[model samples]
Target: PLGMVMGSCVYHIAHQRMGAKIGNIGRNVEIEQFTQALYDARELAMSRMQAEAEALHAEGIVGVQLRQHSHTWGSHTTEFFAIGTAVRPLRDNHIIERPTMVLSLDS
Candidate 1:
């Protein structure tokens, strides 16, 4: 049996104070703070999802997926969602069966 689990986090990026000074200037630079915020949000969502799986006594989560979305909250705001399927072994010595493939020949 498998259980679906999900976690979400909403984040807002702070406007750079130096952005005003650099306006109208043609220059390429890295926005470190914003990048860090994005990483943090993703980690937070994943952590929450793991916590939920732990509460359910699942051995581990499989097929984890992370998603990002922007809605009407504001231009600077974004949401990070993490989802996965929680699975547990039925017995202490459970063995995973190997998948078999069948080839069909038709001309």
Candidate 2:
């Protein structure tokens, strides 16, 4: 069976901070809370994904993809998702063939 794993996290900005940002119209302001939330969510998602791979006794994970979604929870809420496929060593001193491209001298 293919060892596929995934992790998810949900985050929301504080109502007070949202209201404050709404009051500011044209001014360029950086919302630290929102930024922190994004960082935290991403870290949590990655850690959870790694934990899942560990549970599967996998040596490593490949093809990792991270995604975010707002859904119907409005603009203040966001969800972070991480997905990857876990893999293990096939055999001792085994070489895997990979596709390669060679330049043609005729060109």
Candidate 3:
């Protein structure tokens, strides 16, 4: 049976020093906190989606998509959503077909 699986996560990130703060003044500075928060959110969402697939006894998931939403959640908060289709193998042993090409000597 084919099933649809979904997982969602909401996270609140603290504000970090931005441009022209007190002692920080740069053109483009990377914010480690924000990066880590996004990474964590993605991982959490993925794990949850995998768990849902397992509940359905699916072999694997296909067409996975990860999306971000900030619906009136303010600047410091964001939401992550993951969705996919769970599928089971038709048989124990399945073989994939590969295409072959032949070259001609005549130019």
Candidate achieving the largest TM-score: 1
> After TM-score superposition, what is the CA distance of residue 95 in candidate 1 from its true location, in Å?
5.8
lDDT of 1 by residue, 1-107 (tens): 46898899999988878755387267676778789999999999999999989988987887789999987858888899999998888898996454467888975
Q: Give the alpha carbon lDDT tens digit for every residue of 35-86 in model 2.
A: 8888998998989999999999877778889999887857788889999998
Residue 14 of candidate 2: its Cα lDDT?
57
Worst 10-residue lDDT window, candidate 2: 92-101
> Model 1, which residues run further than 4 Å from truth?
19-24, 95-107
Q: On a 0 to 100 scale, what is the lDDT of residue 35 in model 2?
A: 85
Give the Cα RMSD of candidate 3. 7.1
Pitting candidate 2 against candidate 3, the one with the higher TM-score is: 3
Q: lDDT at 18 for candidate 1?
A: 75
The TM-scores, one per candidate, come to: 0.78, 0.74, 0.77
Write down the TM-score for model 3: 0.77
Clash number for each model: 0, 0, 0
Clashing pairs in 3: none
- Candidates' lDDT values, in order? 0.85, 0.82, 0.83
